[model samples]
Target: MRPETGMSATGFPALVLFDLDGTLLDSAPDFVATIDVLRAQRGEAPIAADQLRPHVSRGARAMLAAAFPRLDQAAREALVPPFLAIYREQLARHGAPFEGVEALLAAIEGSGSRWGIVTNKPEALARALLPLLGWQARCAVLVGGDTLALRKPDPLPLLHAAQALGVAPGDCAYVGDDERDIIAARAAGMPSVVALWGYRPEHDDPATWQGDALVASAHALIDPAAWPRPR
Candidate 1:
């Protein structure tokens, strides 16, 4: 199951599934912009840029909650659609692949391997961001949160992506920054890699999560020579 020399994953991941927002792309700039819009609408003071960056990978609802924790439950629900709408307009406006991600995907593709996305973001937004990043045609598959009745941590979407890519669960690997990402991949019977570079709350510890491997940096994942091998 070893990948050929140039692939990102050392073992040929029959399908390499990635979590979009934090695993590959740095999406905080645009996410922060949307937060600013929400803040303005609520007549609230703006949040610090540094304060919001770490939560970008967590998703829109999380960012909203962080910015407006004082809002009641009904008000929180009311703010969601508008927050999402604002984010939609700016999905890829300032996003960029984290360092080495483009090269990693290139190495995988160059080695005749396939890669795709399995994200908790809704389908429409995920689809829209793909073209902006020029990955719409290059990616082998995309399974968003609402693509099916369930999302990550449930395993259905990951299973669907593997199926679509003609890969078996045993041969695939999922990479993400959060604990749920690890849980979803494991539940789907695939190995998981904890991406340490992604957003985490101050108190969170990615190492304690159950992942087959822990990638401390994006460049580390791109380097096949440094990968974990069988004992």
Candidate 2:
């Protein structure tokens, strides 16, 4: 193994798992476009990207809540199918890796360490996005919200990913932009990193998340030295 490159001796914990939407990709644009599609039908102007940026990590339901505040819970719930349909069509149109993410990923791979995605996004959507992101062959494992009965904040998904990768939970590190990510990682007995440059808004303070480490930008992780070490 490449000790200088930081490859694990057992090739377990060989992966760095990440959250898809906010942690790796800048998906707020797609969410904004999707919301604008809904708003336009009612002759409403497009919502600002920032207006929906912070809600991206929470998935469709949260997007619906932010996009249609005037509508009550039931009305918002009813809009999910249509919202997902539009989002699927506009999936990667306005989304791309966050600045420096590509290089960061490359660095990880080049170091003989692999990476994967475990997201709250549906399995199909996450699977579809891999090809678009040119990561289909490179991603070591993918566990989506629907991959198992439970997702983040539950720890099942994270634990399941480690098992699939043949890595002990404590040997893996999870990076995410949501509190659920940290909670899940902590529960799974893995290290965690908070992506500060992700969809966090003024109200969402990542400080309290208590991840193993926190980064102000994806660029900060281009060097493996900046990555959080497994406990």
Candidate 3:
């Protein structure tokens, strides 16, 4: 079903910021594949993709920890470079936007709202992947983890994105699949939505995150009613 479109009660958001991995994009497949490649090179059995999918959003270190639990912190850290190298070589090989994302983006644009991405992925990787997804020119602002001195859960990236869009934090909504996403949004004074469809650890509880709203799928987010509004 097509979402109802028009300015909301508080007016359309000046901007909508999204988390890339897990949120807007299903990138776990490529990440898991990269981990499996590493394991194969060591003559080790490949870890199940399902087992490593949840850690994809948490970044490479988390995936390495899951794939090689026996590895110490230093060992896991050492693997990051090679892991990312392999990941970069096959970044979008299996990555695709979640279902209904294109329609959701259309709805936002139809309302004259601008959208952008705010991700913890490295800037270069994020930039590289955007065009492959045909989103390079469409994104209003792109803020990666390394875009500033700090990343999510610190509010810098979100705030910076709002600033770049020339919108007040309160005039934007940030949607993400991780607790850090909500924390950063709340800290930046923006309404936040928890994307339940994104990568989430089995132990992680979205209920406890205190996000303004929760959406089960990209389709749900296309609805203006699903968006969090300033209180």
Show model 1 residue runs off by greater than 4 Å: 1-11, 225-231
> Which scores greater on lDDT, model 2 or model 3?
3
Q: CA lDDT of each candidate?
A: 0.81, 0.85, 0.88
Of 1 and 3, the candidate ranking higher by TM-score:
3
Position 168, candidate 3: lDDT: 77
A best-first ranking of the candidates according to their lDDT comes to 3, 2, 1
- In the range 1-231, model 1's lDDT, one tens digit per residue, is 333222234454556789998888888888888888889877878788788877777777678778888887778788889989998998878878888899888877775678999999999998999888999889999999999999878899998987776667776778899899999988888878898888889888887897889988878876654333321
* TM-score for all models, in order of appearance: 0.91, 0.93, 0.94
Give stretches of model 3 more than 4 Å off. Answer: 1-11
- The C-alpha local distance difference test score for the whole of candidate 1 amounts to 0.81
Q: In model 2, which runs have C-alpha deviations exceeding 4 angstroms?
A: 1-13
Cα lDDT of model 3 by residue, 1-231, tens digit: 222233345355668999999999999889878998999988999788889998888998899999999989999899999998999988789978999999988888877888999999999999999889998888999999998999998999998988876777887899999999999999999999999999989999999999999889999877777887753
